[model samples]
Target: MRLSQSLIPTLKETPAEAQIASHRLMLRAGLVRQMASGIYAWLPAGLRVLNKISAIVREEQAAAGAQELLMPTIQSADLWRESGRYEAYGKEMLRITDRHERDLLYGPTNEEMITSIMRESVKSYRELPQNLYHIQWKFRDEVRPRFGVLRGREFLMKDGYGFDLDYAGALLTYKKMMLAYMRTFQRIGITAIPMRADTGQIGGDLSHEFHILAPTGESGVFYDATFEAGDPAAAADVETFYEQMTTIYAATDEKHDLAAWEKIPDERRREGRGIEVGQIFYFGKKYSESMNFTVTGHDGTKIFPEMGSYGIGVSRLAGAIIEARHDEAGIIWPDAIAPFRAAILNLRQGDAATDKICNELHEKLGADCLYDDREERAGAKFAEADLMGHPWQIIAGPRGAANGQVELKRRATGERLELSVADALAKVMS
Candidate 1:
């Protein structure tokens, strides 16, 4: 995409309302704009990042055996009532009534809706183990939404539901999801530790929240250093991986175990703040029983299938990643999830040689490259490239272009090297 033809309205000054690094940077970088108190309109650049994150999530979820199926943002109030949470959900739910006088709501979550779907479709134990997921927008009407997308009222989420014939099967499915979540976070270039967490309104005895360590996080966290020593996705045994994760001493401030903290060696102790990005709950029959979702057992008896729900804050992750990875200059986007692979900057926008080199590089890189062809100073272009957080920057100035060379700068390390255009393209593509 050419910068001159793009709609990235980057700002030199940060918005006064943005209190966090992610919020401030996102606005100044022209990724999103506030549409209302707690709502935002994602710009083209922001949407690209969001879509990349969602793709990674979908891939990991599919690898873990979940089928993809989209659910609606609005749901009938009757579904929540069947699960006995219509009144209990509180004001966060934006309850609505249509002209026909029927109650409805912008769903905060899809647990009830999914449960009702399974109840109507699955009637036998033969179809017991089923997992379905969707990536969709959800609304909660946060009373005091802040921190940009991190605490936004309307946001994109990847929520999945799993059903099994018995408790053991449900537990196995939950473990699979844990592994999937770890892989997803790792692929997105972030380290997320799974800590035991309260089920809260979700109502489950077993729950875990995945948190990314960041200085500006809302929750103070205590964890073991082993979490960073190895990759959870490398473990071949799902049960062993799950056991090791749950047994480790990891918790948010609210659930910190002082006695357990002292038990670990001083050198192995690690504590910091964490921003929650995802959560998994093995709620068993919480939804199925209340909603009367039943399946026929082998002997013809009705059984309430054990169920679990897994969730990842799709939109919030874009902000959380910035919170964890940004530097003084701007966001240091991880290569895997960057909006574009590289930015091709024409240091001398109209210079015949520089423009030719940059245009060639842009064409070679195809849609993955952001070509800065705007009539802006070299310094301004550099600043915007850094602020937008492309993984690499290909700079073509008259001097370098005349010599058939271009400077390739790695955003994460601030390393620059003047190389032949061919070599630079190869490096960026590689």
Candidate 2:
């Protein structure tokens, strides 16, 4: 993509309304714009990052045996009524009334809707273990939405539902999801620790929240240092992963166990603030029983299948990642989810030699490169490239271009190297 042809409306001054690093940087970088209170319109660059995150989530969900199916943003009020939560859900739900006098709502979550689907379709134990997921928009009407997408009212989410024949089966699926979540976070280039959490309105005895450590996070957290020592996704099996994760002694301030904290050595103790990115709940029979979802048992008795819900804040992750990864300059995007792998900054935009080298590099890199072909000063180009946070910056100044060399700069480390055009391309591609 050429900068001159793009719609990135980057700002030199931060918006007054943005209180957090993610919010401030997102607006200044032109990733999104506030459409209304608690609502935003994602720009092209932001959408690209969101799509990349969603794709990784879909891949990991499929690998964990969940089938994909999109659910609607609006749902009939009857579904929530069936699960006895229509009134209990509170004002966060955007209840609506159609011209026909029927009640509807922009779904805050899909537990009730998914439960009704299973009640209608699955009638036998043979089809016991089923997991379905979707990536879709959700609305909650937050009363005081702030912090950009982190606390937005309308957002994208990846919510999945799992059904099983019995408690044992439900536990197994929960473990599998834990493993999947670990792998997903790892691939996205973040370390998320799973800590025991209260089920809250979801109503489950077993629940875990995956949190990324950041100083600006909402929740104060205590965790063991082992989480940072090795990759949780490298465990031999789901059970092994689950065991290690659960036994690691991690918790938010509300659930912190002081006795447990003292057992670990001083060097093994770790505490920080945490931003919640995802959560998994093994709420056996909570939705199924309440909604009267039943399946035929082997001996012909009606049975309520155990169920669980897994959720990842798809849109909030974009902000949370920035909160955890950014530096003084701007966002330091993870290579796996960056909008562009590398940016080609034509230091001398109109110089024939520099233009030729940059254009060649852009063509060779194809759509993965963002070429700065704007009529801007070299310093401005450098600043914008850093602000946008491409993993690499290919600098083609007239002097370097004339010498058949370009400078490759790593955005995270500020390390630059002068190399032949061919070598630079190879390194960027690698």
Candidate 3:
């Protein structure tokens, strides 16, 4: 994509309302724009990042045996009422009255809706263990929504629910999701510690929140260093990996136990502030029983299925990643989730030789490269490229272009190499 043809409205200064690093950088980089107090319009660059995060979440969910499905943003009030949360959910539920005076809601979660679907469709123990997920926009009317996408009124999320006929089945599904979340965070180039957390309004006996460490985070987390020593991809058994992680004495401040934390050797203890990116819940029959969702048991008796819900804040992840990865210059995007893998910066835009070389590189890289073809000063181009945070920047100037050489910069490391155009392309492709 050429900068001249793109809609990235990079800002010169931060918005006064922006309170955190991610929020401020997101505005300055032209990734998003505020439309209301807590709502935002995701511009092209922001959408691309959001999509990348969603894709990773989707892949991990699939690997964990969850099937994808789309559910509506608006849900009937009757569904919530059946689950006995309609009134308990409070104003954050965003209750609405249709033109016909029918009560509805912009769904904050899909527990009730999913329970109803399974109640009507899945009828027997044979099809017992099922995990369904969807990546969709959700709304929870926050009274004081701030911090950009991190605590927005409306944001994208990947929410999955598991239905099982028995507690054993549900436990297995929960472990599978825990492993998936760990692998997902690793692939996105972040260290997210799974800490025992209160279920809060979600209502569950077992829950774990995946929190990524960042200085600007809202939650104080204490974890054992052993949790960070294992590789998710290398674990041969999901159950073993899950047990290893959960038993590592990790907890957010709300669940922290000083005695347990102090018992660990001083060298084994670790603590930091963290921003939550995902969570898994084993709620058993919380929704199924309340909604009267049941399957026929082997003995021909009606029984509520064991249930769980897993969630990843797809849009909020963009902010969390930035909070975890950015430096003073701008965002230092991990290669796995960067909007563009490489950028072709035509430093001398109008020069025929430089333009030719850049165009060639852009064409070769195709959608993988963002070509800075605009008539902007070199300083502006360089600054924007850094602020936008592409993994690689291929610098094309008249002198270098004439000599059939270009400079390649690795954004994360700030490593620059002056090599032939072919060599630069080869390195980026590799």
lDDT of 1 by residue, 175-227 (tens): 99999999999999999999999998898899999999999999999999999
**TM-score (all chains, Cα) for each model:** 0.99, 0.99, 0.98
* Per-residue lDDT of candidate 3, residues 1-430 (tens digit): 9889999999888789999999999999999999998899999888989888888888988888899999999999999999889999888999899999999999999999999989999999998789999999999999999899999999999999999988999999999999998999899888889999889888989999999999989999998998778799899898788878877899999999999999999999998999999999999999998888888999999989999999999899999999998888799898888888898988886789998899899989998689999888889888999998999999999989899999999999999999998999999999
Against the reference, the lDDT scores of all candidates come to 0.94, 0.93, 0.91
Question: For model 2, where is the 10-residue window of minimal lDDT?
Answer: 228-237
* lDDT tens digits, residue span 146-173, model 2: 9999999999999999999999999999
Please list the Cα RMSD from the true structure of every candidate, rounded to 1 decimal place.
0.9, 0.8, 1.0
